[model samples]
Target: MSARRTSRVLALWCPDWPAVAAAAAADLAPTRPVVVLHANRVVACSQLARSAGVRRGLRRREAQARCPDLYVARDDPDRDARLFEPVATAVDATVPGVEVLRPGLLVLAARGAARFFGSEEQAAEQLVDAVAATGVECRIGIADEMSTAVLAARRAALVAPGTGAQFLASLPVSELAVEPSLAGPERVDLVDLLHRLGLRRIGDFAALTPAEVASRFGVDAIAAHRCARAEPERAPAARPPAPDLTVEYPCDPPIDRIDAAAFAGRLLAVRLHDRLADAAVACTRLAVTAETAAGERLSRIWRCAEPLTPEGTADRVRWQLDGWLTQRALRGHHPDHDEWTGIATIGGQAERPGASRTRRTAPPNGSADNTVAPGRAVPAAPIVLLRLEPVEVVTAGALQLGLWGGEGEQEERFRRALVRVQGLLGGEAVLKGVLSGGRGPAERITLIALGDELSPAADPALPWPGRLPIPAPAVVLVDRPEVILESAAGAPVWITDRGLFTADPAHLRWGTKDWQVAAWSGPWPLDERWWSDGHADAVRAQILLRDDVMVLLLFGRDHIWHAEGLYD
Candidate 1:
């Protein structure tokens, strides 16, 4: 124990981070336990839930079977983070600088603060109570070292200084945070090795020599050895929080369909953008929150491109939400219920670990936006993202807030609503296209024009490295060039060869008939250079061009005529 480093650690695991997060966020009194599933997959189980025999690693179905009443929520680590930021900030205020373990953990150097606040017991209670005000219910553990504090927080059992080794000794070997003993049947496990070594618990492992553990377990052994004797956990982070940002829209006209949920998400995003601008923070998390009148709430979170911005943030949230909502989703066989629930109350947050509150959104009232020249682009800045959250609930009906006949219900409101209607009535919809950039094969290029939008159109805004030839033509000839026509007078009718040969026109010919000069126009003829590929580079400039009449770059040998656009 003397050889091990000392630490003041605090691990606050709320059994389930997301449920507490959602409960803290909404007006609903949280009676049900919430479990945040990572992409509908289980991550952490709540304390209340654990009492039901539901464990963290168990699958949703398995856990449900164990504790049929467990409220299985999705694991949105990012959402949990976004929701947790303010709470963390509150913690930092209480103890200046602390290390964030994750969305659910934080280890603070509390030796001085504990003394300054009067006592260890007093500080922990004050700290927990202060954070709880942010809507998240948290627990605290004060120890001389980190790993021990983690265990203390976990077991809600604390240990005094110089007693970390004893604290660790009492914990089960499985509590050392090693990989599961069984990862399928083929892979051998540490539990077997520990058993073979005659080590039954973490405390027993503490008695082994560090050199011996290193010989057996390699680098990870260093951490395990430190944990066994109660040491300060080495944080493998350069800085605290990763930068990310997300904006959400709660509900519009507010109802049951995914579309309404998506529509409200846009407005929430815009509002969040405005607030973030004033705060000078850019993040990469986009979260959505949905609430059902029946009290069920669902949320979703995501990551985006680097060097995030308000515009880029808005663009992504709109696109992704639209993709999921506008498209119909077939609900798995509950046959009787046909109506979909909607979203409500969207929020935005930044996710920058160790974010100091001093950063400003815009430049000071009179100062420049950045050091860049006044007319040029501003230098890119750093980002701080809040966790992203999304909620979708199976509600009874849309809430109608009458405003002398405002937008009506979020789903069915009329003419100027935020969402585009897709059912019975037809309207010129504002659709999206993934416009492909550059030029090569027409199949590989794009430019958003008029008419309807489709999938293959390729969004021009996305990064595209390969494009077409330089000085690309503005237009190309189409409709398979009109069949060349000539007149009876052997003077080569229709369009004359009028080229480098001379400025002349004798007679004209068209579709097996000859016509005396009605109004002779151009003798614009071009021939390929001797060294050139025939007709490939043969558009040798000519003056005879007209508006109404087409100067067909006719191909005899291989002349590919491109109409080169119209004059009018």
Candidate 2:
């Protein structure tokens, strides 16, 4: 069988949807004048604002002059999709499947729905009615091609299967720029130029031969011309039905730490992908769901342009958890005052001011509750369960591979070797170093698993006042080692209270022996987080030992000397 579905498609579009979505999010009445702006120009205007002479493409000043009381919302892609998701879900209930072209528009197989509903008109009616019940207005159109269907829907009219071309020919060519499926920056420009050339109707554009159009206008224009002519659309080969691929993990001890959640997400992503690989499939869309200890549920579906590998899925899950945790932190009671029971310090001493002790709480379900130490900031809600569901699947073999003799095979072998090492050493034991943004040598690098998500240890983009001038050190000791800095006469070398070095020549001693410094550089001072309690004030000096070894020494705060790095 031909992999392509029938040419007939049904498109559903919500007119002025950005404006509608913004109004809904703000809980404003639909009759209230609203305008959505992008690049300081009106992108979408509500019916109320439209009546006041506000239309798309008008500059912000022009829009305000036309409608003095316009409630203008800045365009946000995430907000648009988040608000539109409910509408798509409502439509999916009536149609067996729906392909979302964008937030405001979608297309589906018309023949199957029409046959099931008894007629194309009835199918469109059912879809329109379903979306309307969600409190958003929609118009549906059925035509033989997706592009034509989009225009037909704007008019709320269905074109007979074979008459899509005739129906589209009468529409203005400007409508081509309005169809999201067919319109892009280039195609929009083409439409404008076509209007200048007096090809004002789809009929005029469709009259040009495909070859001539391709030769002169380029690829996107050729696609638009084909749509104008109602040419057949050849979809990729159909895959088998999605498998019952779902993986769930119970957080026996609810997870409240963002780092803990990220680790768990990575493991779950790996397991989920392994299961799909066993079934000879790959995931295109993934649904992540989490249940909080308070019985609240959070779920989101993430779609990928390419099949989501374990790393990509893990990253998405981690990002979602971060957002949820951040929001909870912002809205919930002060976490710094929470009665956390356990204290787990990673690599450094407790820098923040406070002493906390851990206490174990027994729950009715017999699960151990692991809470942070009291008087420490933490996520307000702990996740009790995490679930991963593969929403869309594709045949694994269908994914294109690199050409033969390419590094693809070598890379696969290298990955397999790393996996074997991980299996031997335990999952978290074997790690790969990843560079992150940071001014300090120790803070700029992090370690993660070979196939796990990569995130920065510290944001390098922030203004760091006391950053050391680089030529970064080749070797950074994982732990800062306490040392003693002394002058030639055995007097302690120190940075004066005025942020100046006490002496010129210096010797360093860590254990029992002392190393004479052959040459040294001035102390570069840094004071960080001065506005907060427990502020750090330190000075670093580079020393070249007589043994031809170079090292960096830090002095300040508690008057302690520590070896920060080495040039080894």
Candidate 3:
């Protein structure tokens, strides 16, 4: 087994940084009460505002009512991230290998700095002094693991060696929910479930074995349990050299959906992977870039533990595109916007749009505010170009021999045959079903090239509410055939506004034939993508016929019914 790459961690935290940054930008006194809001709710508040019961997550009116003089500013994540860069640079000058968790939070390899400063306590004091020079209040904590270090930083305590788990033991179970690193609906629900199960503390949840946690709660919970037990994740390995070849795809009219980009991404990934395979190398770091029609470019670099598979590469491309598109759409910043897509303009340095254009909402601090107004449509920027460049590559290793080597050989043979076919026909012609996790039956399956690896097309760990229960359809039809549900009196059945059935479904009709219903269930309604302007909101229901055929039906806002899928 490989040796563990564990190291002591030091965390630096700046409290209510959004409020602080906003207040500072406004040239307000440090004693003034300020609160930063998002979605009309208070997300960050100054100490003075907090003292007046203007807490985080409170509505704006409630917060203002509590502190009548509280200065309210809209939440701008770009502003927070930009302003925090200097603090990060300052910390890096004092201690190397700093990892920023978010704008207000960061952790560093503490052992070297502690040794340099003669002790961890002295190191923390020096770090605090360094940040204080920037006029921001900072706290420090040192512990054996990142999560424990973050918690300790919150309380401004240094946990002793081999005692991080013990230090975390007394913290409330809800700490897992509030962890900025693990913020998501899934983590929140898991913590809530633990509370309902009488596990009210981190120690209580950590007492269970990893196997038990994995079996019952899934992979995400196991990750949290590891953190609670003070286990440090494996450190990242050193990077390798970049590949010589870079693949690019240009869209003519541009595309809207991420799935459309993913299709092109898969083809490019295979081409890149094949070249690396010929050179007997594997990619470790992939750089994905997408350019909008209006010349704005978006790029991100992803580093993985192992070599990149075709599906893995495609997945990263899809994820990065999703993040960029969602950010632009939600903030009402199209590629054609005069300013940058996500960055805040400083000191009149931002480029201005043409004379014949719309004036954006510019905040007093000389930054553009991209918050979408209520009922305003999110602009759909077309993706015109995609480029996949390998940032790091390593030597491919020999496969480990096992007793099931014959099966491995068979799989290799199949892969070779598919590749040969792909060389003849286009990549899209050689298709295979890849499972994608989602609430809707049609959305759960994705089609990719035949020889590509089967990575998760979507996050299965997500708490997909209203997803169909198990005994999943055996034969999900690829071509969704249109069908109609009829009542006992031969009239079409319709769903009511309250989601109730207008009449009992007694028959199902295809083009010319009608099938009698033996036994049936559902009309379990599902709503999806209501907020996005690109896709219309859809509602769907699943029904089981007496003939034992299971089918999924969809209802649009226009009340038209269509067959979504057929179960095996």
- Once fitted onto the true fold, the runs of candidate 3 whose alpha carbons sit more than 4 angstroms away are 1-6, 182-185, 238-511, 514-518, 522-543, 552-568
Predict model 3's lDDT versus the native: 0.68
Superposition TM-score, candidate 3 onto the true structure? 0.53
Task: Estimate, for each residue in 1-568, the C-alpha lDDT of model 3 and write its tens digit.
Answer: 0222237788899988889878866777767899999999998999999888888889999998999988999987646654564455345445544555666887777777777778889989978866765567888988887778888998999998888889989999888767555344578888989999999999999999998998899666877899889886544333454546678888876867756766777778778776766676767667676777655555445555346666667766665555455434434553354432222111112223431222234321231111222112222367888888776676665222224332133456677888898999978878887778887666688888775787768977788988877766666655666778888999887778787778887887878977777655566666667577765444556666765755545443445567766666
Per-residue lDDT of candidate 1, residues 481-523 (tens digit): 4232233434232332433313243333334643343333233
Q: Best candidate per TM-score, number?
A: 3
Q: Rate the local accuracy (lDDT) of all candidates.
A: 0.45, 0.70, 0.68
Backbone clash count for every predicted candidate, in the order shown: 67, 3, 1
Residue 390's lDDT in candidate 1: 20
Better of 1 and 2 by TM-score: 2
lDDT preference between candidates 1 and 2, better one? 2
| Model 2 TM-score on a 0 to 1 scale | 0.48
TM per candidate comes to 0.40, 0.48, 0.53
Question: What's the residue-level lDDT of 95 in candidate 1?
Answer: 57
